[model samples]
Target: MSATTLTVRQQLVYEKELCERSFKDFIRLAWPHVDTAEYKHNWHVDVLAEHLQACTDGRITRLLINICPGSAKSLIVNVLFPAWLWAIRPKTRVLSASHSFDLATRDSLKTRRLITSEWFQRRWPIGLRNDQDAKTKFENDSFGAREATPLKSITGNRANFVIIDDPHSVDDAKSAAMRATAVETYLTAVPSRLNDPDRDVIICVMQRLHEGDVSGAILGRPDLDYDHLCIPLFADGVDRPPTSIGWIDPREEGENMFPARYTEKVVRGYRASLGPLQFSGQYQQAPAPDADGFFRREWFHRYEPSALPQHVNYYMTSDHAPSGNNDYNVFRIWAVDHNRALWLVDSFRKRCTMDIALGLSRDANAKTVIAPEGAFALIRKYKPRAWFPENDGTWAAIKSMVSAAMIETKTFVTIDPLPTKGSGDKVGKAVGYQAMAAMGQVHLPVGPIGDEALSEYAMFPAGKRDDQVDADSAIARALEDVIPAWLPIIAPKKKRSMFDDDDSRATSDDCWG
Candidate 1:
């Protein structure tokens, strides 16, 4: 029935039920300012709404959404979703955070405005506590509250739904220290605030930034089991698969995801202005190109786990970082085959203090001692021929610590300090590593860690973290001359003309030396 045909109480109940049943309807009812002519609501909106509705139904406890900016992501998720939650699930508390406090407060204010709007109250009858009405935080009469904060510790605040919107700013994403801080906040600070850890949901929505950004960290970890909803600006037909919610990008290949909003012309302009790297991350939802960069992804050859040779020479190379820095200590095991191809056997990386990095043994009791495993376990397992530690400021201190620990544990292994190289020289070494991989002389063991190493290589000099790449560069420098001079370069056979003679044939010496 139309609004005019219904009784006063009947109309109220009808509107309330309509808003609760359809979040899209609720947006239209609550916000009269949306210009349909310019807004051009697309199919992706319904897809997003469906996934969010699924969140409330407890089907998804963790969600990470990567979408191009200006797709109304913040408006749909940050502003509308929270207020809709209050309408249906009246006592659901929400904790929202952004990279900056001002940004968080802005969304909070919009949500507050929606909740207090005449249309919203007429239907849902939810009221905000008079004394608790604030921009950053507010409490409803039903005991549900919405609190917004910068990406930092939210002391004593608890919530049923934790939402992180754009946790890393563009500039902050380029800095390893800042990216680490953002990831730490997401990993350590926010998860604990959930009122119901098992039942409550956490949603993170942002454009990808770096390989170590929060989105990257979430996707890399399989234990989290996040439901990822990626909406790139252009449809590659496979960027978004069929989600459990039965919503997928329906656009064909080469079509714009939201053509009316981000047209072909606009997208082309973005590509030209943002450059390949930024445009790929921000618009394509992929931080690095698959086959382009200083280190091409296709060049990192993979080997079957079962095909590994038993008797190959092994060596360990490391990249170290002192405490208080965000860098990770990387330990990599490399195997050199008889053909001199370098195989990445194993790797371990962690952001830890010197004690943990070294795996120092400590006294547990009067008769008991506990030996933590870090690099020590890898050394014991692989028994590498030598350990090459980068010759940086921390080299001497690390060598001293390793020596003292070895003497105590009676585990003797050769320790060699890598030749000191300046920051500019490391890039050149990375180029050498890239060249080695391109020549098929570098092989990677097939696994998730290997995939991660390849991505790091592909985004080298542009990625936030480079500890893995640095270790690979160290190994490349040490094994630069391992390729045998006797190895034959087989060139394609050239069809001989009747007039051609043996003297015109190319010799093996004419190949690349």
Candidate 2:
């Protein structure tokens, strides 16, 4: 057993033993036949290896990794990690899942190939049980098994390690129904597949798709304790997870996450191809879409509260949804400047009772308060100087209601009915103010509220909430009369001196006469 007395094959076996101890090293040893030349290791892979090792060692139970596409997420998490785990602990069981059965099967096949390869066999002689060896599911003689199932069919299977790879496809992620189904499956079905709920580990690896994607749903829950490792295509600020596996991003802000593989030019090309919303959700891992829709962040002028000019007129605009569910009842206080530019001074949005809504409108203290068809009761209770409600077939009913309230409460509520069904569509109204925002005629206060409102505007037509946009549109329509008309100022032709050149000379004084 002396070093000098060891044979060449023995020395090679010793080296393989050392390599098998590390996940990345094992990947180098058992890389698949295709694209072996192009397989390069980055720091992210090393970090993922350490995290996976932690998972195997029972240091962390629930793990979520959100990395950009083309970052070899499946190669590392779905394929190599399972093979390496089985090599280390041959009794371990793993269940792999993806949005589609084909994808899961592909990962299972790659993992099986790695396990059955000559290098793998030489390093750790673990043979698959011939009776149970298959593409979708395979087992080793030591009772270790790896099963691949589509996310929907994940019920009735049990495993020590459950890994979900891309539970939603790009197209499916866009659909509300598909996203909900994915979330539902993960919540209701995936957890039951754990053989030992206390000691078992569940890992989810996917790029963020929608704000309601499975990743979003998990991250949104405060009760769930998961170690989140998010690696964006472009490096944002430092993301140091409070976990046993600590990772600090070395790249500066805006640098490519994997500069060696994805150059700035290549990343830019992908961004252009995917567009802002998809690129932001998929590559950037941002919940909000990039600010590039009908409303641009640059179009908004931000002002500090104290620096706000005395408004020439103030109005409150409201958009209400009575369902008291996901939709918000939004009321925005706006101030019109001497230049006729609309400035959003303050705002409030919530799911509340009619009394609270009335209180909010009364607290706004504007000359006029504009609301849509739904808030007739709020207007009658708060009785501002004027209230314009859309006359969309509910005007007659709303007017009678207001008249009854006036007789009962002895209060006058002015109802200026806005034109319904014509050129005055909701999208048309929003677009009209979008032009105003584009022209830099709209201002917003600089604060958290303003930033949130701006995000809603940026995600317009795609965002879940359009209450604020509808309210702003109502304000824009109400201000149409007061908005200054643009007059083309024509400078009179320059008076020419008598000695001026012939081409430049003009008898301006005589022409006026």
Candidate 3:
């Protein structure tokens, strides 16, 4: 060969070596039609590639990578990284699994294609063994094997490198049993699949699904000791991994992780499509299911106590649960104006003995106290002008209990059972209140108490403590009876033409006269 040809061949060999040593470079060279061929290089992909390199070098034994959906996580972690591993160490064994067998097989086919590609074969020369050549499971001549299996079907397989792409699907993640099963498999079956317990590599790549999902289960377990790389879709200014881990986020606050692929408009579209809770979990990687759904914070209207109209009727509503491991006893004082706008004045909620609960009720000092069937006894001691107990077929018993309590305390207070109306369910009542609140018909005093109430409203059915919501809903239900009289009806103003006399614009009082 000529001198120029020899130099070109040497440079080509140098480039081949670079590709062999680097996972990203190997991806570019082997799958030029995929990674860098048409797609712009993303920093998150580089980060994932570097982390996988660390895993390959035995710097990290157990790794957990959480990235948003459509961030090319599976393409990088499952397809490129495994193929790159085999390029350098043909003897390395890899066990790849996903939520489903089809997904695992799809990735397996991609990796197989990369391994069998002309570029990869020419550069690395790791030929697949003739006996073990298959789509889902393939072995190289150097005793290395890559097996693709469903997450639940990995019974007696072992590998040096185990890659679980997404152990739970979106639907599977929603189910507690499915999440538990995935975690159990990860804890029990997956660990046993390690050819060497101490030295084998296990990398889990997935989006945040739920608090009880496999990723959560693994992270919660300190004994497992996984190096977590959480790449949220948006940069939220919260430092996820400690600086000691050397995983610095490249994006600034509010910047998209992969803006090249998903534009700001596209991200917003996703947010609109997924809703807040799903978007928070799947995209932002914040699996706070309680914080996002049911009631949005913006829907609430906060006002000063002075904003209450002068002729407002003040009342208190209660949802009672007895002490000793029951739901909290809650009382919310409210005022309804002539315009039928409901204003939350004051509130108290806690798990207390009946004595303290009664003390709380008296301390409220409202004109009327509306209690549920369970709270009639405790609330009667407050001597409210009108005591309305929620009557759901147990009115007589509730009345008897209130009368007995009044007799015992030597104080008589009028008791009236509130008839069940308009789809009598807690959630239904809450939904009604939510509609009113959304229309700016409900207002809350701006303070800590209001903040607490709004927090409960925001959490709703998903929250751990919903006593505040119950109290609010009860008050809303009570207001349905009171608001008809309170709702203002303004007389229609008479219209006048420009040519009409000034007397035509006179007030309705003048017309009545």
RMSD of each: 9.2, 7.5, 8.4
Ranked by lDDT, top first: 1, 2, 3
lDDT for model 1 comes to 0.81
Q: Model-by-model lDDT, in order?
A: 0.81, 0.76, 0.74
Is 1 or 2 the stronger prediction by lDDT? 1
Instruction: List where candidate 3 sits over 4 angstroms from the true fold.
Output: 1-12, 33-37, 174-180, 209-212, 216-224, 268-272, 287-293, 301-430, 440-513
- Give a tens-digit lDDT track for model 3, residues 1-513: 444666755766876788777877765555573455466677876788788888877789999988888877898889988888887888899999999989999999988988887766666788888999999999998999999999999877799999999999999986667888899998999989998999999999999877677888888897988998888887878766642248777778878787688898898898789877778778877675444576767767888877777766555676666552657767656677776778876665667764455442332554233343224433443333444456654344345555655655465645444566655566776776777777788888898988888766654553446777766776666666643525354689978678988676367688777
Better of 1 and 2 by TM-score: 2
lDDT, residue 229, candidate 3: 88
Candidate 3 to truth, TM: 0.68
Q: What lDDT tens digits, residue by residue, belong to model 1 across residues 1-513?
A: 567899988988987898899988776666563223345567888778888888999888899999989988998899999999999988999999999989999999989888887777787778889898899999998899999999875657999999999999999998879998889879888889899899999999999887789998998897988888988787756655555666677667767787777877887898788877888889888787554557777776788988787658788888888782688988898887777778899877889887777666577553222244567777877888778788789888778778877777667678777777553565776777778888878889888779889867767766766899998888776665333312343589978799976666376675554
lDDT tens readout by residue for model 2, 1-513: 787988978977875776657877776656654236577878888888888888987888999998999888898899988988887789989999999999999999988888887767766889888899999998998999999999999987799999999999998987779889999999889989999999999999999877788998898884678888888887877555566566666678887778888987887898789878788788888755557756788998998988777534555676765455677776666677667687887666777654354342332554233343224444443334445455555345345645654555455655555565664555687877898889998999998868888878876655556788887887677766333422233579979778877655246675455
- Candidate 2's C-alpha runs over 4 A off are 1-8, 33-37, 238-240, 289-294, 304-311, 358-430, 458-466, 477-513
Give the poorly placed runs of model 1, Cα more than 4 Å off.
1-14, 33-37, 236-254, 297-390, 393-422, 425-455, 462-468, 471-513
